[model samples]
Target chain A: MRIELALFASLEPYLPEGESASGRRTRMIDLPGGITVGEVVARLGLPDQPRVCFIDGRGVREDAVLTDGVRLAIFPPVAGG
Target chain B: MGSLLRVDMACLTVKKEPVPAGWAKYAGRALTDAIIFAEVPPKADPLGPANKLVLAPGLFGGTPAPNGGRLSIGAKSPLTGGIKESNVGGQFAHSAAKAGLAAIIIEGRPADPKALYALDIDAQGNGMLNRVDDLAGLGNYETAEKLHAMKGDDKLVTVTNGPAGEMLMKAAGIAVSDPHGYPNRFAGRGGLGAVMGSKGLKAITIPLGIESLPHADKEAFTAAVRKFANALKEHPVSGQGLPTYGTNVLANIINEAGGYPTRNFSEGRFEGVEKISGETMREITLERGGNVKHGCHTGCVIQCSRYYVHPDGSYWTKGSEYESVWALGADCGIDDMDGIAELDRKCGDLGLDTIEMGNVIAVYMESGKAEFGDVQGALAALEECAKGTETGRILGDGAEATGMAFGVERIPVVKHQAMPAYDPRPIQGIGVTYATSTQGADHTAGYSITANVLGVGGTVDPLKPLGQAELSKNLQIATAMLDSFGLCIFVAFPVLDIPAAFEAIYEMATAHTGDPWDADALMKLGRETIAFERLFNESAGFTAADDRLPAWMLTEKLPPHNSVFTVTDAELDSVHDFVAETAAEMGISKP
Candidate 1:
């Protein structure tokens, strides 16, 4: 399965090399079928920190499964207007 | 322990009276709301002589305590037709407190409606209202510059209104001087500026004084201040995330959560979210040599404010915050960052509430006056507002009026005030706050987003109705207390998670006021304050039915999650059950 992933704010540094300077990046990547969000984060070597994750604009937990064509976005903790 | 200054527009008199013994702990919103409830008649016309405008600082204002420089401006709102206390971050509060003023009350309307005057407070906090009709037509920036010159003090803070306010537009907000002497910081909600303008008051210049705020125990106060500042420095949200990206950082996260209101709330997400996200803002601002980290006033550790720049590296305006960005950009279907910044600048200069104006313009678009994403049309509508044309009047009045003029549904307002960035359908907890808040659709009144979305204090399912009422109730109580202290709302981030930080608030207040305050006393004060506001609203004819989301929000489902606002009406009413409970405890009979 293939999915689009976007990392924002401080998490942008974990994006593929040469794309981290923008402070945000979106890229398509291949993933195994029915892979959980936590496994993808670990496989991609993303930092082990508290984050807000979403699959196709719906907030999801780390254990939530992702399928093909989903757009995944992750951001570091943030609050305020 | 400063004096209260009363200025009568009808008599052109300025009187000084010692701060009431009972008002020792009252500053910011508490002081303002108390004054309004005690003095103004409940049914008084918001724009008439019977109305009064009160300006107050927090208990910590002008102190060495970090992030204590906030002002609360209150009145009977022309927009919401309810009691209003709009808070702003600026130098005016610090200067007023340093000048030995607890509050400034403006009363009566000028006999000549077209007359204008400027209220000047000297180093001794003695106020004098001087006739200054020349300032009548000036914008906020020009008004601040002119008042700054008239005062002849480099550190003088000017609070002024623009043409929108002079026109008595309900969307107008009063602008306060920032550190740079720019009238950028705003008490920017509830049509308080219209109240100010109706008084024939053009500007108020207050000098930053040399004296220090008296403390009950300077040593204890110093120690508490240190703990609070250090806690703010240590908190991730305050120390790092905010300083790095500013508040707009929430744009992507909120959009990802499907809570971001888009295209006048016809949708829940914007396709152009990335372009207007905080990450993009930081990159653009830094590339243009603009400041990505700035403070609105002194003693601010978070420094979440910023300066936006033009492509040529020249200053454009203050960086739009998350609310402004979403209100003017996504809600209006515009994605041009530069365009949004330009619109923000216009709103600031015109002394209009950017949130209110944006929502109104979106309603205008729905009426087919212009299409969504028509940046030029939106700009032209603002120009019309400045000129006070017929169409401009409709837009200037706010979202509901514009919707009525265009015969459009889905106004997205509660109590006639426009909603902020979040759509309540997907974010149910915030909806509860919006429906029941005394101030009318103000997010800061409760900010359930802290738990529902940000996971600041704790996590509550944003889409779930359970536990939302309790969450909003507790938050609203804490917020009322926070506003009374004049502490920045950002301080709540640390106070929520850091035990020392929460303890330090009461410690600092106790030492500063010598009132022997504790956490319980402060929370009771919060409850009592809210109860009075409720009483005033009830006297003004608002009933439980007024505490409800618009019919569309309850009936129509928002996209992405396809969720309707599911919080029951009973749950919404329960958020304010404290009003009656507090009244009973305080021995005040409820009407």
Candidate 2:
């Protein structure tokens, strides 16, 4: 299964190896059946910090399972207006 | 009683006036708006001698009011041609209060443009107005350092502008330095810096050393303040959501709601949103030896501000919050956080409003003057503004001018000022406030987020128009009352959920003023202030016609959300009707 993952703002520098400098990471992985977002986050070596995660355009809980071709975006806390 | 400091730059003379009786009832935005309405002529050019700039501390500014150290700067706006109030947080509010000064009004331009002046208010209530020739043309970062270096910083607050204001650009803002010497704090909207620049004043620096703010009843005030602070600490929005993520948490939420204005508002969502959301900002700050969150002013427990640093631990910028990221990054289609930080730094240095300038640049990009997602072009646009070139002049003139020059149709403005990050098509409640606000398209005018949840007598969905006018009216009244107290509006989040918290603050004010009043009276006072502003604007020739969204926003249907501003013109006109009725209820007649 393949997924497009992206990080936001100050978290751009924390992307794993081979990720785009723009904080987008596109990867192919062979998952052991349906995997929860928390499990995927752990597998990717992503920090277990406070953040808002979204699948496609809608917000989802961390326990929501990820499927093939999911567009997952992870963001840190906001500092904007 | 705190003294009122009036500086007439024309003669380089400064005078101290007694704080008017009963004026303490109003603090930050409320006081500034009242002063401007009372003294400034509505028809006066915002950049001319007749206009005045008033800076007032919030009602709870110097005290332990949660998030209370907000400074409101008000003037006739060069951008909106209406009354404007831009609020910011820094050490200035505390310093101003401790120095026993209620507010400082800068009036009348100097006869010589070459001459620059700085107002210094010391701890003993003694002050001097001096010529600051050496500090001219320096950015805020440099100006703050030089001023503090000369003044010996026990607790100094410096408000200065960069080359943008020195050149009288309409987008210029007045930069107030935070406690850490970061020039991140700004009253950055509606060209207030240009107004200050027009007055021929460079900066106003106050040194903090005074003992305490004078309150009529110290015990009551302390108890009330403590009660309110505790409420804020316990409320989920104030205590947790904001402090953890700052305002950037709204990025994903707004995007999810399809209200986030992206790519110059041509779209509702940005493809590059993940790179600039609040969650990412916190993670990166932690890795780079930066603070994810810090307080804006003294005694603020809800620290929704952050210090973003370079990878090497050097300073990048302070408080790169949601608005800055949206305007400079997503709106312009640039996702690089470093690039956005640089723009934020430049705007802070130049004393310009990043939101207005970013929208202006986006308009230029839409017109083919610059390409979308062009980071270097964005930097060049800012440099042009700093240089005050012809290109810069057009850019500096703000969103409306840029839209006119570029022939772009999707210009997002209300009352001549560019709209904030929220697209009003979907968020219809906020749209009402944006259109009717005296400050012109300001999100802070009456942040309707509270009314959006509470519902107005169960008459309609907050997202619908059924009870929006009444909700908007109440919020505006509440906002005006809060602004005058010089209290930060964020305190309202907790106050909204915990009704007792507002009563406590009101009790403190009533005790201090020795006036037998309740929450209803405070609401009336807010309404009175709004009515006064409306009278001023009406006298200056503004009418129902002027209170309108841009034609594009009205005609075009925003995509993805597929929402058009469905409110009718009659609905907007009805907003003014409520103001009139409220004025009558308060025993005030429309002039």
Candidate 3:
């Protein structure tokens, strides 16, 4: 089972070296079956304080269950006028 | 107290006066609105002699407050026919504050038709207005270059208008200096630029100074400033996200939320959003040798501004921020990033408000004056605007003018000004602000985007009208207070979420004034200002009927969520009722 991890804004730096920091998708990562959203973030070692991860465009908590082929996107807090 | 300069353009006279006793504590919008309410007749033609232009810096300016250098330009708006207080981030306000000057008031039009005046604060520390005959009809960039060259110093801070203003175009904005001496920051709304142009004054310059204005409690102010800085640094939005991707970061987030306002607001999202998202902009900026970590003024920790460069590596413009990007790119059906940046540069050169200018261009496209997705045609229209051609002059005024000229009935405007980056139908909170703002569809006037979209203060559903009235009212009052202190509105993010963050602001503001101040005092100040503005608008003929979304917003349901501006007319009227109640609490009598 594989869950595609996408990063946006400052959170993109935590992705693998070949992964792009902005719009273009660099590569997809394969995660173990039955992985929780929290487990994926912990594996990436991204900062815990400033991240909002979305699954299929809906925001999910750390305890949210991940399914195969789910497109997960993460971003840091961004507020502007 | 800081001094005020009264520049009487009609007689070509300049006077220095002590700050009025009653206005001693006011700054920014609060200060400007007070002066306008007292001196300007509500019925005065905005481009006529009776109208006056007031420019003021925020209270924390010349201090250590991060992003505290915002300047507020206020007048009777030629576009909205209502009071306007437009804010800009730049070095002009900061420099004026350092020189112990709080505000500059330009009153009366020139006696001579073509007499162009330039106000200069000399190295000897004396300020004077001079007639510069050669500077007539120059672009903003050319004007900045000529002024800097004539001054022969890198310390010149200038606020000037460009050809759009000279043409008396309603969308004109005053350009202020960035840290690098570029004229990029703008008080960019409500046709205030046309007021400046009518005066026949081109630029006002404040010489750079080293001395800091003394605070009543220096030690306490310093400590409080430190606390506030710490608060900003710790916030992920201010400290990291903005510095990393700039304000354009919202392109992706808003698009993802299905509230991006594309193609004359016919749709809620853009298909080509990824091409112009902040993430893509950042990568492109780096590839093109641009500086993404720049601020509009000094001491801005949340460097949400960026300077873009051409593909050939030469500088283009300082920014095409989220709103400008949306107005030009998605709103017009053009998704080209470079073309959008070029349009931003053109607007800056013309000293036009990009948001308003884009709205007009989009309306023109809707009327078949130009084709959708025609970046070159849009650029050509801007060129004609600068040239002041017949068609150019009509479109230059604003969206309403373009709509009328083209005989297009589906014009999206409130109180004669164009709707900004957000479509109020999907983002109902902002829509409430648009229909009801004193300044006419200004997003920053009462930004409910925090609650509706970003979840900064509290969660309010973007799709539903539930609890939106209260949310907009609270934000408008708080935002009014923040503008008075000269603190960047971005600080409200942390101040909203963290008690200590707000306490730091409260402490810093109160400590500097050496007065006993609290949340109630601040709220009172905001409420009174609102009452005063409302009175001015009322005298200018604004009614509850004027505070309404365009008819299309009610009948035309937005996509994705299929939401109209569900916030009813009664609910929208409630926002002002709260202001009136607060005004009554503060002993402010409505006119």
Candidate 4:
């Protein structure tokens, strides 16, 4: 299944080469249907750091399952303005 | 700082009066609000002779305490028609405090409206008002440069008002010279610059002082400062995130949370967010040879500030902070980075509050006076303000005035002040702050985003009203105390999550003032300060009706979550009622 992924701030360096070249910050990734957010992070070779993850604009835990067509967004620890 | 330097602008006289015994411990917003309550009549016209402008430094200002150089400028506001204190980070606080000046109070409007003067303070803290009529219509950048040229010292810090202030536009703010001697740091809210302009004052210059002020318990203070510094460096939010990407890091996260207000609060997110995110900014800065991680003041370990540059490596502006970018980019429907940077630079040069200026331009766009996403149109509108044209005056007066002029109904404001980047519909806690904050629609007044959005202290549901009132109340009280200490608000991240960081604040204050300070004493001080501000607002004719988000926010649901401001009016009243009751328990008086 194909999923949409968005990485921000310090986590942007983890984007795939094609997405990185696009300079759009968002990328499409082909992954297993039953992948969890944690598995996705691991597969993408993300650094061991504090992060906040969201699926389709709703903040969710890493254990949450991902499905095809869902937009997954991840960000490093950020303080408000 | 044992003396209050009072400059009577009408008579062109300066006097150094002994500090009030009761206000000896007060500094920053505490000192500014206290002086305003004592000297400025609540009902006085904000631009009249009766109103006074007060500049105060925080308690740890000029000390070795990291990020302790915040200056608070206060006066009755011409825009909100309420008491206002605008906090800023710059060299002025450290310079002024080193000269033994607790506060500088400017009183009385000049007899001649065209007269303009500059107040110069020497190393000994003696102040003199010099005629500066030639600087009546310059921008803050020009004013700072000319003042430095006149003094023959490029290092001298200057506080200046630009053409917006000279025209008495309500959105005008006072700019403080940064370490680089440019007027980029600003106390940019509630028309304090108009008050300064009304007094016929153009600028203030103070000699640079680098040595740390003496502390009562030097050993303990030093130990506490070290601990605090270590804690800040340890926290992921403050240490890693801020220094790496600056405050603009929140753009992606807030947008992901569906709380980033876009196109004048008509939507929850912006499609162009990625183009303007912190990652993009860092990439651009690195490519352009700009300083991505820079400190606003000396001894700042966080270093969240940045100096944005042109593509060819020329200096453009100091910062395009999260709020400024949101206001000019997302809120105005303009996603171009260079355009937003230009707006930020223009606001700084004109000494206008960027938040207010963006809101006004957004309102103008909504009214068909300009097209949304038209960068040239926005720039032209801002230039109109520089020229003081009729339309420019309306736009320069701030959001509410522009709304009134353009007949736009969806003006996002509280107490006539424009709201910051956060949309209150999805984030109910911040909405409570916007409605109840004494300073009028200021995010730093309460900043419930820590819990409601960022999960710094603890996680709270952003889409629901449960636990919001309590969260806003606690943060608001803590913010009041923090502002008084002259500490950076970013310290709250570590102080909330780390116990030692929390205790360091109390330990530092006790060692600095030679007093028994603790959590309870700090809470009481915060309570008293709120009570005093509430009393002043009451005297200035603010009633319960004034404490609310615009009616449209409560009725119109925002997108994504489709949430409206669900916190009831009674809950909003409870925030201030609790403060009032706490003040009574502490034997504080009413208006």
CAPRI-style class, candidate 1: medium
**Best candidate, DockQ-wise?**
4
Q: Which prediction has the highest lDDT against the true structure?
A: 1
Q: Assign candidate 4 its CAPRI class.
A: medium
Predicted candidate 1 versus true structure: per-residue lDDT over B218-257, tens digit per residue: 9999999999999998888888899999999999888888
Tens-digit lDDT string for candidate 4 (B496-545): 99988878888998888788889798877777777778888989999989
TM-score of each: 0.97, 0.88, 0.94, 0.97
**In candidate 4, which residue ranges exceed 4 Å CA deviation?**
A16-23, B585-587
Query: At residue B555, what lDDT does model 2 achieve?
Result: 62
Predictions in order: lDDT: 0.88, 0.76, 0.84, 0.88
Would you list the rank order by DockQ, best first?
Answer: 4, 1, 3, 2
Tens digits of per-residue lDDT for model 3 on B301-359? 77888888899878899868888888889989999999999999999999999899889
What is the TM-score (0 to 1) of candidate 2?
0.88
lDDT of 1 at B123: 78
User: Which candidate do you rate higher for TM-score, 1 or 2?
Assistant: 1
Supply candidate 3's per-residue lDDT for A39.
90
Q: Which stretches of candidate 2 lie over 4 Å from their true place?
A: A1-80, B21-24, B450-463, B581-591
**Model 1 shows how many backbone clashes?**
0
User: Comparing only chain A of model 2 with the true chain A, what is the TM-score?
Assistant: 0.73
